[model samples]
Target: MHIEVSGLYKKFGDFQAVTDVNFEIEKGQLIGLLGPSGGGKTSILRMLAGLESVDKGDIVFHGKRVNDLPPQERGIGFVFQNYALFKHMTVEGNIAFGLEVKKWSKAKIKDRVAELVELTGLSGFEKRYPHQLSGGQRQRVAFARALAPEPQLLLLDEPFAAIDAKIRHELRSWLRDMIDRLGITSIFVTHDQDEAIEVADQIMIINKGRLEQKGTPWEIYKNPQSPFVAEFIGESTIVEDASSLRGFGNASDWPGTKALIRPEYVEVGKPSDFKLLSATESGRVRHVHFRGSEWLVEVEVGSTRLVTYRSLEKEIVHPGDEVQVLIHRAYLFNNNDSWIMENKLKEDPMPVHI
Candidate 1:
């Protein structure tokens, strides 16, 4: 089912939690509500699920307005971050609880529970209690319980936040597969950028009680509409001073504009390596830290500290080594923080003397 949120607003006493938030989810699309803590992401989800009343605006499902409907009447399944499983109940009991509440016949509930058990990979653990299963297993049980009702829309609030890092990664892939197979319209809340990027068909970024941007992960990362979206979606360095562009490029066209440089777009090497370097900046390496498969090198160029990610397979440089930093690409934004253009410094690029 398609969902549309128009001019949605929510308030908690004196502070407004959501301000004119609006977005639409296409049928069977698994979208992600991504933001930091207390950024109104959960509030928006709650409002959509009918857990919270809408202070303003309409939430339309398919073609009907669900603003006045209760959560149970909305035909929406919700999964909580903590799993919210019944500790004393076995896996089968938990999964069947929703069906039982809906007054399903014993035979039908039994058949549905069995089907979900196999689908969620919890067939063998059906007789086990919540405490007996691992974190990932418990999460699967939660999903099974939520899906038992066969709701048209699925809402998950930080579904994998409680799982271990390794298990979370596995569950993300599994959940995406399950949702697609079921063809359910799903909206999940997460503070994890990687999770949203890896799972969702579309992502809605929320900050300061406002909808920052909405797009596919690639669009949001590569062509951010604003500086906040650019920095929040990925690693970026904000260049404020025009002098910093000396070795980077000519900022004359966009005077007083701020530039965003992504760590991966930067290249660090010996000064002699870049024969036709358009722009080159010299900086003292402040620190070098290992980031699993890559090295994050921090360099201090005057008062600005820039970070660049280098592959571990490449030549490694130590701290305090003076290196020439090459900018292969950059995103410039006007004073209003609106994106101007993405400058690719590789072909017919700006020239900078090394």
Candidate 2:
């Protein structure tokens, strides 16, 4: 492990911020720490960065215990959400500030700043001030400054939170290219699931200062271990079925299992006869949001709710239109509890998005 955190615990006064959190991060890999606000993602990052002390636990980076190491001595780069740049400094000066403090000679600092500016696509903006640059440009400047000193690992805390959606998407793409090119080991924290899924090599989900799950984007989206994780990372519907979706248990229309279906896997169709429940179908469209080629439609089925993204090509489903949905691929969980993988139905007709 490049960075290993074990039994990490932190508390403030009466509030317990983090408890028994443990995970190992490999080198040259990009990982995402994802959760909503106040979920302790930032707290964990701060602890790793030595900005906050760990109440209990050990932090090992490249086989060295860094508990007592000062933040600067840890050799970890930090990129914050606000693109913290020296407002008075020019782009090149901002990028060179860290190296200058490290006492690098003028020629070496010049070369380092020039290389970073080129690598970050800021070659022509060397003389421009932070306020003179666009949000994306400012972000690039912040990144260049953070990375100039060649830190062992990079930590990003909600780095794209302040940018607009379009800009955020663009910057995420830009970041993917730069990090891959540099082969840097980094961990970024964000509250957006889409950001984590699209950008991270592996994702760590946090809730209430605890680790909920950690895995590839596909694995986490397809096979969530907990209910909170199942509902959070992607658009999914959980159906209470009378018969288990998997054949592990008796196949009868009795109180059985919870069926989970991703919106992309759901189609407007009648429930097949082989389905768990008898013709007990009830739903009405509540609202629809058009998403270019497809539409995200929310429906209320009895007391439960489901969201489906239907393409306009097949039957043209819409708002206020009643639908008989076919859950092409669904996860089946026992009604009694979430454990016991029983009565699973594979051989789905629809394609599972990767």
Candidate 3:
């Protein structure tokens, strides 16, 4: 009851979106595959689900290689982001469609359809068409249809993006619980960081077709292996002075493996004499965006812009007021720009240009 993918590669002409990706999922584990739009998250999922062919790779399930198996023969469930329901069919018809295609007995199909509708909370809406249901209901129908087939692995491709915000949250929770109860191994692909963090048991982040970092949500967020993964996963603003930090190494090409830190984690009001260029700059507030409980304050320290999230209770700075910014920390990168940790948390956050 496990799934393994090794050395997956996909290229459209010269674009190698997924390169040498390898990972395995145990039975009943929910894996969150996260990355930017072009990072090849979908490509990897498609390859596993037999939707997209791979240039080279091995996909195995339960100790048997299944890379060449077609979607139906592989016994995998696939739910697309777009719902993809037949507009002419009722909710009951949609769920029963897959079972019917498999040539299951009519009585068995009826029983399974009833059970799925109940599990997905689509009981009352079974008579309704896709157009008549809310976005969440439609998504539930999609889930029921996929589950009715009883797949070895479920592949979800951003299933909740089209739903409204409130419903998206509820559906994510519901879907996670439902999948867990079923004890089914699943791979969820999403471009939204928050959604990935909220739903996935284990997150695998990829950048430009390469595995950047894979771990628990808290682990990857606190310790990113690449600047692209860090910035892609949260509200990140790169401060230029990170180049000279002790372990940051000599700056040659790419931004020294980014000193990745979230805006909320930054500490303000440190003394200006910290000896870092960012600490010494007297910058004026440029713009401020209210983010409910916190304010996303944008400050210009000379030519570079640093974004910080401050508690709302503090007096908001005006556009012209000069403010001191202290960059207490950063990290080092190899010549190729892969992120590496340098300073410890207790260490200074103020930037020290080596």
Residues 44-114 of candidate 2 have per-residue lDDT tens digits of 99998999998999999998999889898999899987988999999998999999999999999999998
* Higher-lDDT candidate of 2 and 3: 2
lDDT of 2: 0.81
Question: What RMSD value applies to candidate 3?
Answer: 4.7
Q: What TM-score against the true fold does each predicted structure earn?
A: 0.93, 0.86, 0.85
Instruction: Give per-residue CA lDDT, model 3, range 93-146, as digits (tens).
Output: 999998999999999999999999999988788899999998888888988999
The candidate maximizing TM-score is 1
Among all windows of 10 consecutive residues in model 3, the one with the lowest summed lDDT is 244-253
Clashing pairs in 3: 244-353, 244-354, 327-349, 327-350, 327-351, 328-348, 328-349, 328-350, 329-349
Superposed by TM-score, candidate 2 places the C-alpha of residue 170 at a distance from the truth, in angstroms, of 1.3
Candidate 1, which segments miss by more than 4 Å at Cα? 247-256, 340-354
